[model samples]
Target: MSSTQLFRVSGISLLLGALISLIAVLLSFFVNPSFTAPPATFQSPLWSTHYSLFFTALALTLIGLPALYVRQRGQRGDRLGFFGLLFIALGTFLALGMAGYFISVLPMVAAKAPQILKATLTETSFSIFPLGGTLFATIGTILLGIVVLRAKVFPSLVGILLLAWAVLNLLGFALQSGLLAMLVALLSTLASAVAYGWVGMILVQQAGVSGEAAYQPQTALR
Candidate 1:
């Protein structure tokens, strides 16, 4: 594909990812009333909705990876860019795993105690999944952000935001508190939206133009 086409595809991927994430954020509140409240207990409806959104977001974020791969492969910075792609893949998997765990557990919990929506915090089958998933996703996003920044394939601002998001995610994990983690997660989501939006706008502007016509790199030979 031409450079313009590649960019357009990447831009579309980013926008889709952003849209899915936005939906997930909105669904979180409706699916689980406690989502707005302190993370005291998990509710079936809420957990279900959360998992759905998480998975959808994961799918959207991942859709862009291949485009990035095709653009970077065989290029000057293949090694670094490839590694970044790997990180994004890993993060996406972890995020999915987190969502999967929640989805699996909600049914069982609901079946046993349909009436009791809230339960005390305790070690359960579902709890660990989010923890692991969040960890991987956070790490992956951070790496992807760095790659984007270094590759200069997209705006540097997006990379910076990704880096900041990763740091926030790590901080949230370190705290091991729900409210804190959610807050950090929110920051990450916001940063992602901004980054994606920027990429989309750039792509739309550059569409139908050849890469050479749009971006001309200076070579040392010159």
Candidate 2:
């Protein structure tokens, strides 16, 4: 396929991935909580549904990364773009691992003990996975913001928002209050998604330009 075609596909994939991820985020907060909770234990259907959507988002996001990489490669600011991709990949992995551990493991622990084991596992998961994942994700998102700003592939507004989002995420980590942390995390995730989605859109447009340039006649008919 031509560069234009590739980018077109990339744009659609990126948008689709972002949409799925947004759904996953919502499901995590809403659907997931309903499952395997008190009075129900190991009988909630929401748990399985939540896990399914979470994994779906994970898979789609991972698949979208390669398309992004292909779009950025060979560009003028390729290095920064490539670095951005690296950061994003690392962040994605960390986030998924943390989320997976919480959704999969915590449920079982809560189901079995319901008191001591549940609380202990919850504390352990938050202290270890969330803390570490947030740190890694914050760094990655910040780097990605820098790359996007420097490359000017997307709107400057998106870049600025990404940087701000990264700062907010880092602050959330430091504060450690449930309400405050959740608020910041939500903002950061949404902002980062917008930035990345814009990048994908821009890449798609550039691909069309690239295709046109490639087909232009060299040395006209002198």
Candidate 3:
């Protein structure tokens, strides 16, 4: 009901999201083997569980993101943090849709429209929005890293981890063709989970001390 309570809830949500997302990332390797392949990988029994966990992660992240920025930006405002939150929120929402499709629609497609599913996996260029969402989220995270350093809301290590995650992902995506790239991509996910977890812990600590600190402008949309 109060600002402190809201922040505490947000912190818990972020921590839980980070944990779930990390688990999903780990399970994905058993399913996809490669970061960019989805052709035959979807047949794995873990596919649904992986995406289900991913969906839950994104949902929790979305819920906590507002408080993340609110707790850091203070009354003066930081445009960078606001935009970062906006980008991440939009991207996560899009990714959630893709996860839902994977969990629900893809199965039906495989059963009834095998050809469609095959094409969707092999040459289906239309389903690129999930990639787009990832891009936005990555960029947003990088921006947030910078904002963190500037705001001094958390330890410098937290920002460094966030930056590392984005940079590694960028490296992986740009390389796009080697075993090294895949490893870098996987590292990026680990860095992301650690960064978020660290930040969430700090947020929880801040919440307890924030006291009567009610932040206005709940979201960038306002």
Off by over 4 Å in 2: 1-6, 27-55, 74-77, 115-128, 174-177, 206-222
After superposing all C-alphas onto the true structure, candidate 1 shows an RMSD in angstroms of 6.6
Clashes of each: 2, 0, 0
1 versus 3: better TM-score goes to: 3
- Tell me how far the alpha carbon of residue 184 in candidate 3 is from the true structure, in angstroms, after superposition: 2.7
Stronger candidate by lDDT (1 vs 3): 3
Task: List candidate 1 stretches off by more than 4 Å.
Answer: 1-7, 26-44, 72-76, 113-132, 176-178, 204-207, 210-222
Alpha carbon deviation, residue 218, candidate 3 (Å): 28
lDDT of 2 at 206: 78
Estimated TM-score for each candidate = 0.70, 0.69, 0.82
- Model 3, C-alpha of 71: deviation from truth (Å): 1.4
Q: Give the C-alpha miss distance for residue 174 in model 3, angstroms.
A: 5.1
Sort by TM-score, top down from the best: 3, 1, 2
Root-mean-square deviation per candidate: 6.6, 4.9, 6.5
For candidate 2, write residues 34-74 as lDDT tens digits.
22245353335565566556556655656666666575466
Q: How well does candidate 2 score on lDDT at residue 25?
A: 54
CA shift at 180, candidate 1, in angstroms? 3.7
- Give a tens-digit lDDT track for model 1, residues 1-222: 766786687777768778778667656444442322433335446667766876876676676556655554664556666666676677677667756655675466556764443452243454454566566666666666766766777778977987887777677656654555556656767777777667666664566455555555544335
> How far is 96's C-alpha from truth in model 1 (Å)?
1.3
Worst 10 residues of 1 by lDDT: 32-41
